[model samples]
Target: MPVKYQQETAQITWEAAQALIEAVLKEGAAQKIAFSIAVMDAGGHLRAFGRADEAAFLTAEIACDKAWTACFFGQPTHIWNSLVQESHMAPLASHPRLMAVGGGYPIFYQGRLIGGLGVSGGTYEQDQEAAVKALSFTGFDKL
Candidate 1:
């Protein structure tokens, strides 16, 4: 007898992505800051995005790259930045599509990696704050 095998994967749903983006936008508005937010699926595919008025035009792409980097590494980009700096691996920071910035975070649900969130167009601390705030609303920040 032969057995069948199956594979399963988790992804960030459209509704959740929209909610996260909205929350980030609201946070940015409250801070009187403009931002570009991007959400990417576990496979590093773009799911949703938003850019606040007056945000830098380049932020759109930067936000996406940040999200991709987070999903790719399964960790916050800031952590990667620190690791690179501490290890003196400066060359890794120059890699294309791998931004070790402070605004990118990998999203997890029930111990499973679901997706990534990226926020840009503000200082690193500001962007990290907005991203974490948005993730908190989705109940994914603690993971």
Candidate 2:
């Protein structure tokens, strides 16, 4: 292999990220809940974020962490719970941005990892539902 080879990368567009945020908010409204939603690029950088007027302010950071966990790990944030159970893996929990909650999911398109979506301000199950609903509504792959 060449010392410095090129590689292709796919990313979530700003338009798509905005649409995902809107869809999550819409889902929250339909469920009579407030939510903070965040979208992160494949590299775990914040791309878009939004919140319902009544959502808890603290949920902003939680939402971003959730998305960061999912995107960077290439798995749902909740998976961290089981992954860290082993003694040898316990230290992984110390990573500040690793959210072991159910609201974050990786975003994929045609088998390509594009980004991640996260929702907060409700029960973990509810947050997960919102994230999944938005991904489905906006034509993103569901995890």
Candidate 3:
């Protein structure tokens, strides 16, 4: 048999990114909080982004960082807080793109990691809520 080291992986479409952004916005509105949102491909590249008029300016970058962090780690950005508590993982706290807060989640489809989603501008818990709601509402798994 031939070596099969490579395999196909799903990529999040531009339209899906946009839809996720819209879904995030909807959830933010429901929560009565403005949010900055970002979506990234599996490679941690930004695919789509948005910031509500009332969202803090800093939220934009935070949202992007959250998405990138989630994609880069293949887990929710919030997990970094607990993960970094380990003595050896503490060094990760210095990485510029590592967002150890909340509002970041890996996007999964059929057990395949496809991309990431992040939301900001509210409390970390609120951000997490919005991220999860938006992911499921958009037919993606928040894993």
Candidate 4:
């Protein structure tokens, strides 16, 4: 069934998204670990998605949430790590639609914020590596 939306949206270009995903997977070759990747627009809306053949289903959703959190907050997920880990902040740690882990990164283009990328189903460092590769693929490595 076709879904309905109250507002219209402009999605990220598929070619750009694909380029980023492929670069990320290539970067993971040395580790031989599969991953699920998600990208979101500057507004925190999902723009693209990809998963390795054997990646877990949940990884995709988590990846999206992670990217969304980073784009929406305009910062890396790890930046919120300390705040969310505090006892008082624990109550909000499991917020319904966001992630506070270290694997998502915002994408910037031409000196402006463009979108973000998220990678999961691998070690945090590996996931971060993948995200970085994706950003590099988009020519936003300086970010």
Candidate 5:
């Protein structure tokens, strides 16, 4: 028997991403409210994605950035949004890759950070809801 040496890279599967998208769509969200959903690996690199028909070009990029920000910062992007509101922290806007916006959330499994999700192209609340739902549908249900 020959032993094979292959390095395995951590990743989220496409089925998981699709499940998330279906869940979000089933929530009565309209097609006109297109969404750019992004998923990032544990290292904050893009793993998978989906963009609705009406989603804007910027939507995808922003969504990815939000996911990366959440995963890399190890906290909900909403926290960064909130912190930016403080007079003392306004300068964080200048921080490279720091997005003071909603729609970004971390995905955790077994109490470990495994990935992140970001949704765009809807109202802030809607975007947040979709992102959370996506995480839940992906089997990180408690996220």
Candidate 6:
């Protein structure tokens, strides 16, 4: 006899990604800041992206890399900044896609890691605030 088995994984749906991006954009506008935002699925693949009209061209790539970095490490990029500052871990800063900044955050749903979100354009603190605000809108903050 043979048996069939399946595995379940959490993922960020396109609708959810769009909503997250919209929330981030609204937060940026409310704060009088413009930013480029990127969303990545659990596999680190780009799911959705948006850039404000006045945002810098470079911010698009930066935001994508930040999202990938957060998903890759399963942790926020800002946390990596502190970790990499230690002499022994300083080399991590040299990685091409590893941005040790505050704009990137891992997304969680129902206690499961689902995706990542990144925002770039304003100050690091502003970027972080926008990302957090978006995540909160998704109700991830309640988890």
Query: Which candidate has the top score in lDDT?
Result: 2
TM-score-wise, the better of 2 and 3 is 2
* Clash count, predicted structure 4: 0
lDDT of 3 by residue, 26-126 (tens): 88888789999999998888988988889999999999999999887889988899988999999989999999999999988888888888899999999
| Per-residue accuracy of model 6 over 1-143 as CA lDDT, tens digit each | 87668668789899999998999889989988889999999999999999999899999999999899988888888888789989999998899999888899988988888888999999999999899889998787432
The regions of model 5 sitting more than 4 angstroms off are 1-11, 25-32, 86-89, 141-143
- lDDT, model 1: 0.90
- lDDT: worst 10-residue window of model 6: 134-143
TM-score quality measure for candidate 5: 0.79
Each prediction's total of clashing residue pairs, residues at least 3 apart in sequence or on different chains, is 0, 0, 0, 0, 0, 0
Candidate 5 lDDT tens digits, 23-88: 665542543578888888888888878887667899888888888888887787888877888899
Put down candidate 4 lDDT per residue, 1-143, tens digits, no spaces. 98776765344566777788888777766578788888888788788888988788888888898888878777777677788878998886778866888888877666666777888988777888778766876777465
Q: For each candidate, what is the lDDT?
A: 0.90, 0.91, 0.89, 0.78, 0.76, 0.90
Worst 10 residues of 3 by lDDT: 134-143
Ranking by TM-score: 2, 3, 6, 1, 4, 5
Clashing pairs in 3: none
RMSD of 5: 4.9
- Residue 97 shift from truth in candidate 6, angstroms: 0.1
> For residue 120, what is the lDDT in candidate 4?
90
Q: What lDDT is obtained when candidate 4 is compared to the true structure? A: 0.78
Residues 1-143 of candidate 1 have per-residue lDDT tens digits of 87769769999999999999999999999999899999999999999999998899999998999999988889888887777786578778778999888999998988888899999989989999999888988788564
Error of 4 at 110 (Å): 2.0
How far does residue 143 in candidate 3 sit from its true spot (Å)? 2.9
lDDT of 2 by residue, 1-95 (tens): 65867788999999999999999988889999999999999888999999999999999999999999989888988888888888998998999
RMSD of each: 2.0, 1.3, 1.4, 6.2, 4.9, 2.3
Per-residue lDDT, model 4, residue 38, is 86
